[model samples]
Target chain A: MFEQAISAMASVVVDPYLLGLIFATTILGVIIGVLPGLGATTGAALLLPFTLTMDPVHAIAVLATIYVSATFAGSITAILINTPGTSAAAATTFDGYPLAQKGEAGRALGIAVISSTVGGIFSVLILCFAAPLLARVAYEFRSPEYFALTVFGLSMLASISAGGAVKNLIGGIFGVWLSTIGAERVTGIERFMFGNYELYEGLHFVPIFIGLFAISELLVQSKTVDKIIKTVSMKAVKLPTLEDYKKIWKTILRSCGIGTFIGVLPAEGATVASMIGYSEARRWSKNKKEFGKGSIEGIAGAEAANNAATGGAMVPTMVLGIPGSGTTAIILVGLMVHGLRPGVYLFTEQVEKVYQIFGSMFVANVMFMLMGLYAAKLFARVSLVPTQILWPIVFALSVIGAYAFQGQLLDVWLALIFGVIGFFARRHGFSVAPIAVGLILGEMVETNLQHSLKMFDGAWWMILTQPLALMFLVFAFLGLCGPVIFSWITKQKD
Target chain B: MKNIYLVPLILSIFSLAVIAIALQLDTSPEMIVGDSMQARSFPIFLMILKLILIGILTFQFYKNNPKPVALEKYHTWGSMFLFLLFYLLTVYTDMFIGIFVVIFLMSILWGERRVWVAFLTATITPGLVFLLFDYVLKIRFPRGMLMNLYYG
Candidate 1:
């Protein structure tokens, strides 16, 4: 594994094409993240089709690099404009804007960039070491275990949904039902096709993602195209001095660990991780009063955790075919598009590919960190682009991206339909993340359940014989219903 | 008419329709000889769950009877008409032309009166995007009535 990883690193260094693509994508990602109203998920979704023309190594590298840098770039806007470019950067705004208010925007940005890079690199290292070992353990899993795993993945809908649990779960189940359209894979029966030929092959993931994440957002943004307030002139991005580093080094390191841990959990990605990390940093700091008022530690903690969560999110995505976050869900689709199946077999059969991913992530980390360090002032201007021009371009890209996958007009139409649905769903306070989760894991759930039933001759009690499956089933149940149960108990006590 | 209650009402109807359709799916005995859960089982289960959720939402909305959702400065029908018009044009015309016309018209209609900026934006942005696919990346896009003749 080490030899393969080393070789992959060497290959990345030698291949100027890949390095250049990584560099360009890193910059693009920063710009995307720096822009308010465009998050990592949308950024990744837009660039997804662009990666189709490239080699798999370069493709994954570009996307992964974009994912990492974009998460960090959000902090720039969060600091400068008091509007978080991404949801994960929302916490950064607490102290970040204040630091800018105090004329220390440069210092705050420097700390944010460094902390984000460190956190990202730290999580990548964890993904490097942990995914392979976890893959080995995952090799032991079969039908029953796999079914339970899918359940656990689905149960993550509990945390991801922004509304009432019931509402979110409904959205998730709706998406799963939608995935059941077209001919049944195992049964060969035309199930949900309303006689449309397009329904014969089921809903394509990429176009749906494009419509839901990008187009829907455009529609919503169109309704509320207000004036952007680019009032503050961004100061130079100053590199943190040795004293600055010494002050928040421990907090940054802890937040990296915290972010990775949260990220590894299904559906709990950067936003939640950064929130937790920032609070944890405040809780531990001796200077707690300075948390929301120009605290470098606050910026450090949030930036580090959010960026770390990107790498941490990759863990489940690579090892188990379960997406750790919405952005990773898009990355999962990208993986499937590249003809790469992400599971235990992927580890053994495509160890080289896995190593290549780690290598690419490493390069992306270094490149984006350097980019953020030097060119932050230039990139900050990206946030100020008029919504008039931006949404139109996004619409154009969405139309083409939806069409590129199948060369079919049907996909584009389907994207349009989904875009409309997604817009309403968002307006109604229903989260799209749950739908993405459900759509992604629907196939896995169906296949595994079928396999388990077939393996045990319809004996549902066989799950008791498998300890790991039983544990996962228990976890799944608790995960989905835990919040409801907790709320009820609290009410009863009151 | 544009109340918060309409959301749940629409959802319940959609869910009911889905359930009705899912139930009509023919998963006969022979098809499910070995397995327990049929193809329709998951869909039916999901639809029922959705129905229940919609029911809860409907009950709450009616009981509380919240104010109609006020859309701020929204031209709802206009935007919807534009979306439908633009997407329909995409299928009939060249992809590039469709995009340029849609964005330019939509932006102008919504706001942004700058002619050169809007014109350049509408042309350059969509042109570059689809051109990457049609030319650089070698992905196919509709040439429409205009571009194919020029190429030929």
Candidate 2:
């Protein structure tokens, strides 16, 4: 097995075309990653169709490269502009932009790049060494376990719902409801089509994701564009001093750990990982007051966690045929399209392919770090481009990307519709993340719940029968309730 | 009366109505061989949950009596809407014409009213997209009638 893995990793041919594709796609991913509204998932989704004709290995390499590099690249905008390029980078802006404002932008960028590289490399290594073991563990998960896991994921709404506990639950429940729009999964029943044939297949994720993230953001930004004073000058970038690095070492370590853990959980994407890492870092900080104001630790924790989350997310994706995040779910589609099934069998059966993927991810991380260091100043200048020119280009790409999804005009129309919906959602302070999370987890929750119920003759006790399921249920519940509990405790103390 | 909350409330209600209609059409079975539950189970569960959430949210809006802050100025909603409308119109039209015109018009909408700049953007953007998507990526786009004009 080790020999096979080694040979597979070693045999990855770095021909000129492959190298060029990797570099070009990695750069493209970085550019997309730097755009606040576009994320790794959107980047991957946009680029996915282009790879359909390429060799499966090459396609996997390109997609993996984009996925890995884009994950790290998002921190650039977050740190530089204080606007998170992807939801995952939200925590980075907590400290990253502040550091940029203080003229230590270079240092913050350097550390973010380095720590991200480290976290990514570390996760890849873990993936390499522990994939078989992890896959074996994943194999043990039954329907009940999966059902519990989905429940646990939904429990995360406590942290996500901004208005109140009830609001969050309502949002999550709404999300699960939305997932049911397509044709029935079990009995092939066509529920809720309203006689529109388009409704028969149910709501496509591409439209919903595009609507919630891109459209909603545009709407919100439209409302607040006046308040969005472009703050920093693009002139004279600064790097972190030695002292800054020394101070943030602990934060980087803690955040990497946090991110990795969050990443490992199925359906919890990098955004949640970064948020948790940032919040935890703040909680554990000796100088918590310095956090949102511009602490290096904040940037370090967030960037490290978000980057590390990519590797963590891949854990379940490559092992259990279950994706840990929305982006990975799309990646799962790509993997399946390439005829690669994600499971423990993949490691034993397609060890070479797995190794090659792992190897490509490592290379992508290194490339991102190099590009981030050498081209920080150039990328930062993107901010100087007026929204007038920039937005049109973005709109054009959005249209092209939407069409490219299935080469269908209908998808473009769907994207536009979603864009409008997204715009309004953003204006109302309703987060797109929960909607996304809901969309991703909706099917998982429903399917699993039904399966678990069947196993126990429709009895709820089956959920608690399996130790793993119970543990996940408890953990999810705690995760959901933790913020509220903490808030109440703090309030009492005060 | 603050009407801002009413918008989302109405939207949510509309969404629920759509969902309810969709659910009614979902007459699929409850189980298949390989997986645990039937096809309709998840969707039905989700629809029911959405109904409850929408109902609660609508109620919350009424109960809370949330006030509307003045919508921020400078957002060119009309321009944005026009841009979207033009984009949809272009989809049915010739690809080159659609791409060129939308780019030009969107540039104007975004406040780049310069004739030269608009002309440059309209032409260059499609050219670049064609080169990238068609030539480099090898993904064929809808050539529409422009295919006969250019290739034939």
Candidate 3:
């Protein structure tokens, strides 16, 4: 296995095109990542169609490069603009923006870049060395385990819902219901199509995601168009001072660990991992007051965890044919397009290819660090671009992006419809994340639930009878309800 | 606020109506894998859920009367109208020419005061897209009249 891994890494010869592609894609990923409301998943989805005709390996490399770099790139905006480019980077904005406000923007960005690279490299190494063993472990998992994993993922609702428990539960339940739309997996029934052929496949995630993030944000941007611009005009990019590094090293390590663990779990993606990491980091910090106010530690913790989560996300995707997050789910589709089934068998069946992919991720992580350091100033300048110009360009890109999907005009219509829906949802205060979560996990949840039901002769208690399944169910319940319970307890005490 | 649930309630009903209409269309037993359940079950379930959620949300809206979050004010009508008009126009026109024209109009509407900058952006944006998506990435876009007229 070690030999195979080495050979796999070695086979990735660094040619000019590969290097150029890596650089270009990473830079593109950074730009997309830095833009508020456009995240790694959407970025990957937008770019996926363009990769349809490319070499599968190169496609994977470019996408992976973009994915990891974009994850880190989100921090740049979070620190400078108080707006997280990706949901995972939201934690960074808590303290990062504050630090920037106090003229420590350079240091915060530097720390973010360095720690993001470290956390990313650490996860990639694990992916490289431990994928086979992990895949073997994952192969042992059954429907019950997946159901449990989903439960655990849903538990994150407790942390994400800030409005109130009832509202959050409503949102979450609505999400689960949304997942049940389209065609029934086991029964092969089309439920909600309203006679439209497009409803046959259920809802396509691209339009939904674009609606949730981009469209919703556009609406919010419309309302806030008059806010004074907050651009960081740093004289020079500041690297983290020695003392700053000393302070954040522990937080970085812990967050990376948290990120990787959350990432490796099926269904839980970068957003959850980052949120959990941020919450935990805040809970454990000596300078808790500095959190959300621009502590470098907060930025480091969130950035490190989010980037590490990418590596963690890939673990299950490479091993179990299950994606932990939306981005990897798209990647799983790409893998299927390449005629590859992701499972333990893949390690043996496509060892070199797998290793090369992992190896390429490592290279991408390193390249991001270098690129981020050099291009920080240039990217920072993007904040100066007026929203008037930015929104139109983004809208144009949306049109082109929608059209690029199967060259269908219907897709453009779909994007517009969803964009409108997203805009309203954002205005009204309903979290768009759950809607996306519903769309992505809907098929998996229904199919697995049905399959498990059949296996247990339609006894819902079978979820409890199976230890692994029961454990996961408990975890999910805990995850979803934990925050409400805690808040209630706190309220009572107060 | 009087009809907080008016939009969603109506939307849910419309969705159910659409689902009902679709059900009248030809569906096969092959479409139904086993038992009484089939591809239609999920959609029906979704419609039902939407009905319930909307009903509950409506009830909650009346009972609690939650205030609408303060929204930022902007000249959204102009932008929205322009976007809608452009989108409709593009459906009938060629994508390239339509896109170019729409972008120019949008930039102007977006208050890009500089004519030279607006023109340059409008022209170069499509060119960049053509080069990137068409030339480099090799994505075949909607050629529309341009392909038929120029290439053919």
Candidate 4:
């Protein structure tokens, strides 16, 4: 494993071509992340078509670097403009904007950069050591266990803080139904193709992702095209004094632990992690009164946790077939597009590929930290780009991206159709993330259920007899009901 | 019914339609195994589940008495219509031409009165896209009438 890790590092980090790709994508990521509403998921999805002809390792590395760097770049907007570039950085604005208002934007940015870098590197190390072990354990999983696991994954979406539980579940089930549109694998019989040849393979997820993430956001941006962004001026980022670090180092470390754990949980991501990190930092701080009022600890805690989540989110995505968060789900689609499947085989046979991801993320974290220190002012200027101009370009790119996949014009139409649906769905207070989760996991759930049923001679309920499957099934039940139960308990207490 | 009930109402109607379709799926020997679930079974089950959830959601909204949202801005709908037009143009004409025209038109519609910024964006974007996708990646777009005329 050590030898493979060294080889992976040498190939990914030392190779000039890969490094240059990483550097360029990281800058692109920074720009995307600094612009409010264009988060890491959209960036990765829009770029996925461009990476179609590249090597699998290099393709994934580009997406991963973009994910890592974009997550950190969000803090720049949060600190300077009081607008989070991504939802993950929403918590950063609590203290970040206040610091900027106080003429301490540089100090706030410094703490954010340092904490995010440290937290990101720490999570990558954890991902490196932990993902393989988890994959090894997952090797014992069979059809029933996998069915239960996917069910548990779907159920976990009920607890997502976005939209509402019932709506999210409905969206997930709807996505699963969408996935069932094509011909059945075992039977080779069409279900809902309606005689269209393109429907034979079901829907391509790339166009769907581009539509939902990129075009939907474009529709939303249309309303605010004339709105201007107000930014706090900073000539250059200033490094935190050693005394300042002395105060925030512990908070940063604690957030690193908190963020990684939350990120490892399915359906949770950096947004949730940063919120918990901020609250927990305040919970343990002696300067609680300073929170939400230019507290460096608050900035450190939120920034560290959000960036750390970019790495921690990769563990389940690579180890299991399940995605860890919304962005990782998009990354999973990117991987699937490249004919890469996540499981024990990927870890065992493609160990070098997994290590390449880790190395890329590590390099991305360090590179973005350096970039943040020197060139954040330039990146921050990206937010000032007129929305009327920026969004049209994004729209064009999205169309190209949708078309570039398979060189099909039909895919572009599909993207536009889904984009309209996505706009309406968002307008109605529904999160589009759960729909994606359902689409990605729907096949796994159906295939594994059929396998499990066949193995038990059509006795589907017999799956409960297996201890692992039973445990996961029980977890699935609890996961679906856990939020309702917790909220009830809180209500009772009140 | 309140304005918000349209969401659940539409979802329920759609679910019923899909379930009706699922019920009619073929159950021949080739498509169906001995006792295992068929392809339609999963979707039918999901539609039922969605129907039940839609019921819960309707009840929740009823209990909460949610307010009706204001109409969306003209620009939002205009942008979407323009985007649809862009798609049709690409389908009928060329993608690059579609891209250039839509960017310019979208900018104008969105109140970018500065002609130079709009034109520069419109021209430069397609140029870069052509250079990158056509020149570098070697991916050929379908020839439109204009391209056919030029090449021929």
Best by lDDT: 4
Candidate scoring better on lDDT of 3 and 4:
4
Assess candidate 2 and give its lDDT: 0.71
How does each model score on lDDT? 0.84, 0.71, 0.71, 0.88
Residue-wise C-alpha lDDT for candidate 2, range A22-126, written one tens digit per residue: 788778878878766667877776566666667877888887887788788888887777777777887788788887788777777887888788778877777
Worst lDDT run of 10 residues, candidate 3 chain A, spans A161-170
In terms of DockQ, which candidate is strongest? 4
Output the number of the TM-score-best candidate: 4
Q: Look at candidate 4 and give me any clashing residue pairs.
A: none
lDDT of 2 at A159: 56
Worst 10 residues of 4 chain A by lDDT: A5-14
Q: Candidate 2: what is its chain A TM-score? A: 0.85
Task: For each candidate, give the interface RMSD after superposing the true interface residues on Cα.
Answer: 2.0, 3.8, 3.8, 1.3
A1-494 in candidate 4: lDDT tens per residue? 88988688667767899899999999999999999989998898899989988988889989998888889999999999999999989999999999999998988999999998998999999998889889988999999999998998898888777788899999899889989988888787788888888889898899998998899999888878767778898766889999998899899999999999888887778888999989898998899999989999999999999888878889888888788888898889878888788889998888888888789888999999999999998899888888889888898899988988888888988898888888888888888888888999999999999899889989988999989999988999888877678899999999
Error in Å for residue A391 of model 1: 0.8
| Clash total of candidate 3 | 19
Arrange candidates by lDDT, highest first: which order? 4, 1, 3, 2
Model 1 lDDT, residue A212, Cα: 84
Off by over 4 Å in 4: A490-494, B30-32, B149-152
